[model samples]
Target: MCEAVEKDLYAVLGASPSDSVQQLKYRYQKLALECHPDRLGDVCDSEAESGRRKFLEIDAAWKILSQELQQAWPIDSIVSLEDMTWDHDECVYTYCCRCGGQFIFSEEELPWRQGNDDEKKRNESQHMVVCCDTCSLSIYVKLSFV
Candidate 1:
């Protein structure tokens, strides 16, 4: 797809920035089915070229939209301390937001919460659960106590 066309991926998918992922997916699927090359049923039809082109554009829009959705909402990924992704990185812990978002718990927060020192310093910390800012969902995370 051309760079100019890429800029309006949301518009191409019939989506607005405010639309939820589910809404965007639904719209994209509907448009995709409508423009699918095979949906024309006749390869020799005069509009076949146009329909094929439309399908390509729709497919490209979906690909771009899907990637954005995934990044914005990583969801509940259960990462362990051993993953090495979090090693000395800065943040204390990370957790999923019910709204398909993620929030990080900082190292600065560990000392402020009331907890058993031994538990905090052990191989694992208690599961600290919190609600998602975007929705009425809960997020759970554990600190690497070891």
Candidate 2:
């Protein structure tokens, strides 16, 4: 089975992780319509097979992206890494939540934190989900290493 982490869902959908859910949906739908096997009527065998594969890929991408969207939809806000305050003592980044709570971001949660030195050197940006310590609200923290 293909793991979600093994495949770049955003790349499959020709999207960026920073893209809004609505943007992702639009891109997915456009790609799906273009690659759908039914739209390849009367094509050669190879062409039809290729279309089927592309359609399946688009479908899988949508399924995964949609699931992620659903999971992140409840976030109270999106916070940029620079906007968060870093605590040298606690060694964690924090953002103030509206409910008098704090959204804590740790280094361990970073996507590129586990790889080799070369991997760590290649700058990339992505979002991490963090929940308020004192409330039900969560925030999407944008982490960048540019």
Candidate 3:
């Protein structure tokens, strides 16, 4: 796993995070429509590569922010207790992966609070806390099953 990209959601869509979900959706839709690979004309090798990369990033950003999507287990899938490890020194529960992101908590912090109903209803919403060791970017994923 890679670290969280830490992209400002606003910057990704060229709109503010405070923007309504409708606004974000519209912005993403417009970018996707305008930048579709099919619309890019034949071009030099470098230019084509750049266009392809941008299109892929845009599609990924949209998927990350889209209302219809939900978080799945990380590839390699942490499905059981044995899959996780405790970092006694850090006092955090860290996953073994390329990114090294940890669930920052003491035993006191166990049973992290889940998101509220409204947050779930609004797909634009996110969990309150998480961080990426790779980018030092904070994010929230709906966690479950270990």
Candidate 4:
């Protein structure tokens, strides 16, 4: 099923479509705090409920905007051709290719994060240790599927 995209968040947050995720997040947080319900109550009793609703709206908008921003200005992901290797017999591979300390997988058929300890251990073992070949230092990697 197709999900409905929210078109009004830009106007609600007073942000341009091109605004970076960080920019959107900062703007939303600032606006949410400025229009907090409790703060609004002191100014106008009738506007308190309205302010609360807007706050919720902004929170929702922030969630979507942040995701979009991350996609646009993704953390540096660099893979070096020389450092990647494959173990065809085990259907496993390891890489020293990444510039930043992160790993990403493109296999859509595999189930990644859901499993028991034995499965976890098995998967961990399959992963070839990836590290900075230049520094020979291991960097922390964040995993995500696209």
Against the true structure, whose lDDT is highest? Answer: 2
- Better candidate number, 1 or 2, judged by lDDT: 2
lDDT for model 2 comes to 0.75
What lDDT score belongs to each candidate, Candidate 1 first?
Answer: 0.59, 0.75, 0.50, 0.52
**lDDT (10s digit) by residue, model 1, range 1-146:** 65652358888887887665545666787898889988888677669998998889889888887776656643454444344234266754545554575455444344323234564344443444333446544334444553
**Candidates sorted by lDDT, best first:** 2, 1, 4, 3
Backbone clash count for every predicted candidate, in the order shown: 0, 0, 0, 1
Clashes of 2: 0
lDDT of 4 at 31: 90
Q: Sort the predicted structures by TM-score, highest score first.
A: 2, 1, 4, 3
Q: In model 3, which runs have C-alpha deviations exceeding 4 angstroms?
A: 1-5, 67-146
Rate residue 34 of model 1 by lDDT: 89
Alpha-carbon RMSD to native, per candidate: 15.6, 11.3, 14.3, 14.4
Residue 76 lDDT, candidate 3, scale 0-100: 29
Model 2 is weakest, by summed lDDT over 10 consecutive residues, at 113-122
Q: Please provide, for model 3 over 67-131, each residue's C-alpha lDDT reduced to its tens digit, 9 standing for 90 to 100.
A: 43223222223223334466788765554344575433333232222223454434543222333
Determine the C-alpha RMSD for candidate 4 after optimal superposition of all C-alphas.
14.4
Q: Per-residue lDDT for 70-110 in model 2, tens only?
A: 67547898888899998999998889988898877566445
Flag regions of model 4 displaced more than 4 Å.
1-6, 43-45, 77-146
Specify the highest-TM-score model's number: 2
Summarize candidate 4's per-residue lDDT along 13-125 as a digit string, tens digits.
99987543434655786798887776775656567777888888888888877665544443333443234454565454345434543332222212332233355544543
TM-scores, each model vs. reference: 0.48, 0.49, 0.41, 0.44
- Model 3, position 10, has a per-residue lDDT of 62
